[model samples]
Target chain A: RKLESGDAAEARDNFAGFKLIKVLNENTRNKCIFVHGSFEGSDDDAVVLMEKTPFDKQSISAMLTSTTDLKQVMQNDIYGVYTSSPPPDLNGINTTIIYPATDRHIMKYSAQQIYLINETAEEYQEITLPFIESQPFSLQWVYNILDKKAESDRIIFEDEDTDTGFILLPDMKWDEKLTENLYIIGICHKRGIRSLRDLGREHLPLLNNIAKKGKEAICTKYGVKENQLRVYLHYQPSYYHLHVHFTHVNFDAPGMNIGKAHLLLDVMENIEMQSDYYPKKTFTFTAKEKDPLYLKYKAAGKM
Target chain B: RKLESGDAAEARDNFAGFKLIKVLNENTRNKCIFVHGSFEGSDDDAVVLMEKTPFDKQSISAMLTSTTDLKQVMQNDIYGVYTSSPPPDLNGINTTIIYPATDRHIMKYSAQQIYLINETAEEYQEITLPFIESQPFSLQWVYNILDKKAESDRIIFEDEDTDTGFILLPDMKWDEKLTENLYIIGICHKRGIRSLRDLGREHLPLLNNIAKKGKEAICTKYGVKENQLRVYLHYQPSYYHLHVHFTHVNFDAPGMNIGKAHLLLDVMENIEMQSDYYPKKTFTFTAKEKDPLYLKYKAAGKM
Candidate 1:
């Protein structure tokens, strides 16, 4: 597909040739490499970001069959061994292993990039609060899933109760297997709840139910114990839907960092202590420089 | 030097032959490799953990000169280049560049190993709190530094105020430079206080002084802006002394994870909201399986 720079032009269905220019920025922590270039027959500049995806059990198991042209780099009693593949194999995959070939190596290589943001409670109110409130968010996807109009087959568990009901399903990022990287999302059935800020004591039952039933269902289906899971919610969630994230403790999933994530238990406790804890409490989070919210803060001279 | 297994025998300061028995566990995230083996002339089982240290400016600058026998692993218009050094160089350094040769690659490759531990507020009181309180902590080294009995030259900043003073020094792990991996610690003048749980409203002035003057001193000396610094304190600190950590925002220093680190700003806010917030709050953190606190939890069947 083609996108003309700064033209607001529609992308064409067919993609053409790509030309290499230069490297832009490579974030190793995030496992993403960005390069700037252009498409053939188009005079506009383009950027290509190649990111390493989280490894699922299937992909890890298939590595032995798919790996090829492995070349030994170096070996030592102290440093272990390093190996890399020089040529692209039949599957067009080039492999590299540092020190050892294990799942730990893969997990560390593909760890998510995290940015820590520190701001006063006042700054959050002046900049982030209004920005999140004014976002033009649509709930069509959430409604569709709740009404079973779309992705009905993906639902793992559901309850029809009005106040405390929620739909549980595997997060798109997950492979739906009983692996350490298991990820699931719980979307509340009740409406008008946008994000953590809107959470209150009245919603305790819903939150508790999601935590309780969600763990039970995962255990029943995947045999994952409750203690093995880390449940939390992102304050400045990507979307406005009220959703809870349930991931294995060992997974090291994205948005689990302190400034970005608030544990479900902590959230409930905060609300129990104060009915409007989330709303009254100050939150600190990171936003990309190019994000409209960040730009608004920049324009307002708050950041 | 060697010692027999299950014996409290002294060893002569002489090294002998070395052998690797087997690879134990490799943690990529932590950039550490563990192997079980034994040294030459020794009949005792030995476990060697090879942990990647943080890179300072000097080591990075020496890479070009130290790198040798560089071999191209793979190159593509889409994936960039991968390279490795087959032979150890004269300096005994082998090089490997996964995708691009950038600092981010090195930084991500050397991130710390973090474990997450979750316990209820009551569990912390019953297990971790008592464990820390009962610990036989000695502050002789801290006292020596404060009295200029030792390490006076290493002190970057110091204040003599009894209630709101501290001696700031470069953490030993740091390279003592103003690089992205810059790490500094502030040891409080007021003694008796231990970890985060011991903090209260009375310690507000001391904490505030550290946060304010620590940033100013670092900025004045290193030219690193206050915005580029992350000031926080470790809850389950390595030592019993009450010390605050000051690190460069770009540096992924160890113990800065959500469960381990508490931002100074957030700490102050929590205290302002409630005089005994830290004491009352349910603290969640990760403890090693071998930690005495973890053993206590296991004994209590709390985990």
Candidate 2:
């Protein structure tokens, strides 16, 4: 009640009602755990509550390998479901999946890649959209995607902004540059917040820091001039998690596409002009036929 | 003559009578200096020579910042163009651009991608062929792309069959992967060799070693199982360089397209079965309206 209207921190601390579900796959020897909690909504019958702690692959690994790992694994909890939900798929290939006793919580953003979209718009209506509509929302798998480097070491540097701890990861490709240049991955500690629309003015400092101080670090550490680095975010990212991509001007990385890439500074300025800049405007992103998300969008006639 | 016929190493050792140029910009303070030299050719009036070493940005920074920078700064090396010619556009952006005044020889290749391409046969012509046709045989630039980290520090592990050095770079995108698995950028030290098409039986050791030993190293380093790592090459790469991509089997990256990515092991086997496996076949890759190379291909009627 109080948490819903405005208090994000209070909402995070109150994780008493949710059930924690763990997903295990021995083939991967990886465990993906997701939060299962729900609350009644004004319009929708039941909406799942999402945690706002950004995933730490290292912590998850430790949680899976050891029984006595620390209980307080999350940095800060503050996530809530933002949109319409996808149904859970019962016919998952892995038999080790466990479901919470209450089957009404949690959801997934059916992710898709634009590059692999080989189907016509018509195909979207008939085939692709149906598959997405029918497919299960696999939140557990998405949770298990981060590994140790993300949590322990891949961090180039971090900053304190808007009462949150932000992480900086150098993309492996950027590290391989022939010259000392900037290619970085910026991650926020908040979890369950899927895309740019989730961000508010509170995130401004973190975004600006990376564009300025973070860029300066690249020059000192990699010896690349400050001007060479550009920091930006992807609208329809490779995944749903909120992360910023930083790269040297010269290296033509996969997501650096003009249509796809959005400069971080521009994002900040745009938000300043309009509090709900992202949500107010619709931007195009690439989604493939096989992606379950594609099917949902197609069925909605949004594709 | 000695440089092309049976003496790639010896030719590298003999450096005499060539002036090196450096490009610097003060406003942005970004300096991008390319090596420039040329000579007369056998058939065409003059053929320019290109050097084989890739640029080392770190080394250049060291040179620019300090006097006692221990690294060797490459200067005064002689290079001659090596094959058929592309008429140097007199209307180049930089007037200082000289046509092979020292044209001993020069050459080119066309490559493309399928994602941007929609029409079946039209794709084969417009987007695909043009990409292949106009790609600059910038052996000089490619040679300088590999830095020391790629050759030495970046190597996950080494094997015996390959006498040549192998470099493993982490993909810029892979840093975000949750698990500490193998998302590698594999580089070979053979300068002037553009892509897999340029590889031969003599390079077998390096290829096999990486697939076998490199895979093991990834498992040992990242705790990923052997089967989890996938090694591959991008046809008509973002750039013309002989580098292979390695990633976790679960990750669905941009170029993982069935029509684009070529498995390194499969490529090696294909080469063994036939010497010119890549050269004998035509494949597609992606290029945009903005790519200068696309313009060249369109003008040549292949696009």
Q: Report the number of the highest-lDDT candidate.
A: 1
Which segments of candidate 2 are over 4 A away from where they belong?
A1-303, B1-155, B158-163, B180-182
Q: In model 1, what are the clashing residue pairs, if there are any?
A: B17-B40, B117-B285, B117-B286
TM-score of chain B of 1: 0.73
Worst 10 residues of 1 chain B by lDDT: B86-95
What are the per-model numbers of colliding residue pairs? 3, 47
Best by DockQ: 1
lDDT of 1 by residue, A32-102 (tens): 33444455665655443333322222222232221312222321121212232212111121112121112
| Candidate 1 ranges beyond 4 A from true positions | A1-126, B1-24, B35-68, B74-81, B86-122, B133-153, B176-178
Please state the Cα-based DockQ of model 1 relative to the true two-chain complex.
Answer: 0.09
* Per-residue C-alpha lDDT of model 2 across residues A1-303, encoded as one tens digit per residue: 322222122112122233222221111112112322232221211222111122222232221111211111111011010111111110011111112122323334122223222233365445643664465646443333243332455566766453454666677666555653456777665566556755667667656766676666666777775435556788656555677776765544566533356667557765664566555343434555566666665576654
DockQ values, each candidate: 0.09, 0.01
Q: Tens-digit lDDT track for model 2 on B13-123?
A: 111232322111110111111223322222212121111111121222221111211111121111111111111110001111123223212112111221122123344
What is candidate 1's CA lDDT for residue A221? 83
